[model samples]
Target chain A: MAVEVQYYVLLSMALFSIGLFGILTRRNALLFLMSVELMLNAANINLIAFAFYHGNLTGQVFALFTMALAAAEVAIGLGILLVLYRNFRDVDVTVPTTMRW
Target chain B: MIYEQIAFALFAFITLASALGVVLLREPWHSALMLGVALLSIAVHFVMQAAEFVAMMQVLVYVGGGLILITFAVMLTEREDATDDTETNADEVVQT
Candidate 1:
């Protein structure tokens, strides 16, 4: 039997939900960055699945762009995390309360 | 057809489990390892779906580049004493 597109969609949804849960519940800055990566992968999965199902390359192209963006995001995010660690000696999300107003 | 189904099931199971591990593991290094597993599984899924270019790109970009970045971040930011305290604090918050 051929694998239907819906199965891929379901898998993507499951991954996205797990990532969302991690982002919402995790307090560590690194975990938060990891969750965002998970979410990006979920999106990439959906994009490539649909691209294959539709017999086109647009989704694949977009997925490549998404990967580039994700790389840049991780770079900037980690840079910020490094600075945050240097400043506060911790990467806890709750520790950066200087601008809490 | 059956083989394809089996492959999909296997890859999906691995990807999901490792993704969960990424979020659930207490140690950041372990989580990073799980993330690598999840990314590889996703690359396999891409190959199964007949997106060879995307699959290779996934391996290159995420497994090669992203994993290295995460490792560097983990190494650069890690402090033994502070990590223990942070782990305890995070665990307590998670438990509640």
Candidate 2:
């Protein structure tokens, strides 16, 4: 009746892969940010799942820190995204070619 | 016991599907909504795993704050005419 930890691990892996694929294929900067968040969520899921499996609170505590970090990341990332849109007039990831060598 | 398995399957399916929708949707607003759904489902999963505090935090931070931030970004960055033109172009590519 109890859910196996493997199932949770597999679920997180699938989510992480989807996020990675989006990062690689999506041209929209906002989509990239969303993908990154998805990846982070996957990591958090793993942390908590392992914590539960091991009967310890370390993983959950780490997950809490991860959430705080995610919050800060969203704040900084959105600010950068807003600036990028203003400067380039588009949120397309391919627009910023100036840095390309 | 059986019910727990069923709930787990349901939550996992919803979470994965909406996560896919988040990345694959053309409209940013739609993607944002899907992301919200995915996060909510993950919160449900957290509850299933007995991490009640994490589940609440997931709802508060992700569903509440993160979603609003994404929605605002989508609104602020939207240029209606430009988006329409781009949408048509994307449709053409998809058709081909």
Candidate 3:
């Protein structure tokens, strides 16, 4: 049995939608970060699926770059979460409007 | 035709359910756990699509690295029930 491109695309769409809903509804900062990760991975899956179907390595290479970007994202995201937690004492992202200067 | 479609549908269902759990669960620890499951399922999906290397990296980086960092961050952060001091700071700025 072979997998179809439409199957992967539909799965990616479903994952992306779930991520969007999470980001929209979750007030917690950590959950928001997870949602962002979900969205990024969904895009990566799309790229890889395209790469496989087209027999081109470019899409897989792009997925590698996407994963690298995700690593950078987690670094800066956790750093910000740390600062937000230190000052706010909670990771709720819905509550900040001031800059520390 | 039917068996393959059924298997794919089941996998998709599992992936979506776990991903939903990751966000909907209130406990960050639980969310992290669900995220691990979701990542693993997505990796299986990747393998099913014949993207073997991507699938392996999905498990290695996402479940191994990303979820671990998320759990550590959650643990290090303040508890969910605490009143946010940052709110007070914002209030002070508005008053001044």
Candidate 4:
């Protein structure tokens, strides 16, 4: 019972869509970062699946790098979040006093 | 082989459900906890895909490091007296 790559693709797509929905609907900056993480994991799943399909370690290695980058992204994102809160007195993205659309 | 399929089905369900929880939950702390579940299950998925080392790193880096940072942000950013925490303008979701 070998699993098809398509199953993984579909799963990844569903996960990515959920992330997108979160990003679109949620105003919490932390949730926004978490949704970005979900989207990144979706991409990671694809890399690992295709690596398994091709019988190589490249995808796994790249996934590791992606995780490292994700960790760094979270670190910086949290820094910005703290600053946003400090200045705005709220976490709502729409209530910022410094930046406006 | 059959067991692998079963396991994939089970964990994939966990992954998606918790991911939804991460988004739809009322509390950001709850969402952060849900994010932990989603991250760990994703590690299990890496194991299923035969990337054992990646699975380990996923747990170590994502669950251990990344999730901790997110939780800290939630704790640090949220105010104790502020109770009006709500999403802003659901109307903007459909707009360009």
Candidate 5:
């Protein structure tokens, strides 16, 4: 049997769950960032796959916008991480409450 | 039937493996590098699905812009300590 669109969707979901797990469990600040990227990529894959399956340009366009937003997010996030590291001399995110909330 | 299935399986494996590597690796820098590889592979997969524009944008925006920003973030954050790492692991960073 040939591979189907649903297979891709399932893979995307599985990858998304793994990324979520990483985000929930990992303590390293950078690894946490990568996990967030992984989740975003999972959503992108689903969008693009559906775009292909449906023969439309919408999903792809959405993915492009998503990529743009992700870029902006990382830029701001990195700036904050830089300052946080400087203030605390560490990047562990557990102490965020003492600093912010 | 079998050959097509094999190819599809290979592509799936490559994608899943790299995605997993992004989380599994110990070093933050290596994880970012692997994430780039995963994004590039995803771009190729998009091409396979006949999404030429998405594929190109994936390369240009994701690999070019996103990955570069991530690497720069890693470089700017100077957390040299390997121990005492604990995190909240919540607060999913989302725009909007």
Candidate 6:
């Protein structure tokens, strides 16, 4: 591979940080979910890059597994957001502070 | 080698920019579109590394399934911000 693995690492890092920024700054729950996905894909990029570098299929396998988990996560997350909307009539993550114990 | 370098630079830029768009865009709808762009570019990154299956799945799962869900949420959860503009437009139509 002419492209050094370093480039992938840097790209993934930038993507992950962008996700983190979204999570930290945005209050809307759906935006938070998207950011989390961004972070997850960043990790996947690393796995695949290392897999290619090492000449094994393990990284690709795990990347598939990660994709599965991400799918399930979004499903459950959207369900919860639906409920959050029904209960609070709003999707603001902060609004659930009313659930404080 | 030259082509690989150029492709990496191009897609890396695309991935980063659209990712930033997902974070920085004010409207959830627009953010969803940006997320789609970001995911598709990430898939390209996968292809560059010879993970063709992963790239296809990225397009199928992330863009097809995940993005649709996100757009549904954005549409369903659209609350305060869009209401006024819609209301004003409705009133204008009635007056006309």
Best by DockQ: 4
> Which regions of candidate 5 fall more than 4 Å away from where they truly are?
A99-101, B1-4, B83-96
Query: Considering only chain B, what TM-score does candidate 3 achieve?
Result: 0.78
Candidate 5, residues B16-74: lDDT per residue as tens digits? 89878887777778888889888887786777677788789889988898788788877
Give Cα-based local distance difference scores for all models: 0.87, 0.87, 0.82, 0.89, 0.77, 0.90
Tens-digit lDDT track for model 6 on B6-90? 9999999999999999988877899999999999999999999999999999999999999999999998888864544322133
DockQ of every model listed?
0.53, 0.47, 0.43, 0.55, 0.45, 0.44
Q: What is the clash count of model 2?
A: 0
Q: Return whichever of 3 and 4 wins on lDDT.
A: 4
> In model 2, what lDDT does residue B16 have?
95
DockQ metric, candidate 6: 0.44
Docking class of 1: medium
Clashing pairs in 5: none
Q: Which tens-of-lDDT digit does each residue in A1-101 have in candidate 2?
A: 58999999999999999999889878777888889889999999999999999999999999989988998888888998899889977777666777989
TM-score chain B for all models.
0.86, 0.84, 0.78, 0.85, 0.77, 0.83
Model 1 chain B poorest 10 in a row by lDDT: B87-96
Q: What is the CAPRI rating of model 6's predicted complex?
A: acceptable
Q: Residue B96's C-alpha lDDT in candidate 4?
A: 18
Better structure of 1 and 3 per lDDT:
1
Residues B1-96, candidate 1, lDDT per residue (tens digit)? 999988888999999999999888888889999999999999998998788988898899888998899898888878657535454455454322
Runs in model 1 lying further than 4 Å from the true structure: B82-96
Q: What are the clashing pairs of model 2?
A: none
Q: lDDT: which candidate is best?
A: 6
Q: Can you write out model 4's per-residue Cα lDDT over A1-101, one digit (the tens) per residue?
A: 66778888888999999999999988888899999999999999999999999999999999999999999999999998998889876677766644543
**Which consecutive 10 residues in model 2 chain B have the weakest lDDT in total?**
B87-96
Q: In candidate 4, list every pair of residues with a backbone clash.
A: none
Model 4 spans > 4 angstroms off: B82-85, B88-96
Q: Score residue B92 of candidate 3 by CA lDDT.
A: 41
lDDT per residue for candidate 3 within B1-96, as digits (tens), equals 777678788888988999899878867778889888888888877776677888888888888898889988988985754554333344443432
The candidate with the higher DockQ, 1 or 6, is 1
Q: What RMSD, rounded to one decimal, does every model reach?
A: 2.8, 3.4, 4.2, 3.4, 5.2, 6.2
